[model samples]
Target: MNETMRPVLGVSVAIWRGGRVLLVRRGREPFKDHWSLPGGRVEWGESLQDAVRREAAEETGLSLHTPHLVDTLDMIGAGEPPASHFVIVVFTADATGEPVAGDDAAEIGWFEPEAIAALPTTPDLARIVALSQRS
Candidate 1:
């Protein structure tokens, strides 16, 4: 397939503790400096659950389990000409231990659903957070 025709696969994890969800500030683009779920691209030969586990550990320093599929996000780039396309698999998982930001995260925090609206985030983050909370 052509480069533009190939859809990149990625995973994002929604980790909840108490009544708040974990979020990481992206240290890279396409949504640099924005608060978003902890995840990254799915490497070749990796299962979706494995990708979610790996990404969550890399970004948030937490071990996650039982990643249940929550949603799928289509991120179509916008520019003079469309630049990229990503099909992100979103998951909700249970986690333990305090989080420390690493990898592609600039910072990390837990926020209530109501508070998420006030922060800048990737598209549909608030909705994803809400959906994950219900799962």
Candidate 2:
């Protein structure tokens, strides 16, 4: 079977501090109003590092530095209305500035470890967060 579908590549920044991770409420389609990590599609001709920095800055008004690539995830929705699958590259980063909500995010907030379970997150996102916390 020949399939013409190509998975979209997404880059997300997992900014952690004081046992909490930054979460953003998306205000657009394909998970609209859902709280998730900060990120978006990677553009052509841009390096992965550059994509990370650009996505981070565009979504959250913060400059990321020393963003080490951590993990790659293949995400697929499980409900009756399945969502498009995406290949997400997550990076653990250290930044020197405060975060302000921007871009597709309607609002942004920090969530403690205990609060993560209550937030609406994809399975891949939950797995990545767990793996990142262990490292």
Residues 18-135 of candidate 1 have per-residue lDDT tens digits of 8889999999998999999999999999999999999999999999979999999998888645687889999999998789999999999989899988999999999898888853
Give the distance in Å from residue 93's predicted Cα in candidate 2 to where it truly belongs. 0.1
Estimate the Cα RMSD of every predicted model relative to the unseen true structure.
1.6, 2.4
lDDT of 2 by residue, 1-135 (tens): 127657789898888888788888888977888788899898998878899899889988989877887799887666544457788899888776888999998999888767777787655666677666634
Which candidate ranks first by TM-score, i.e. highest?
Answer: 1
TM-score for each prediction? 0.94, 0.87
Which residues of candidate 2, in runs, are more than 4 Å off?
1-3, 77-83
Location of the lowest summed lDDT over 10 successive residues in candidate 2: 75-84
Segments of candidate 1 deviating more than 4 angstroms: 1-4
Clashes of 1: 0
- Predict model 2's lDDT versus the native: 0.81
Residue pairs clashing, model 2: none
The Cα error of candidate 1 at residue 68, in Å, is: 0.7
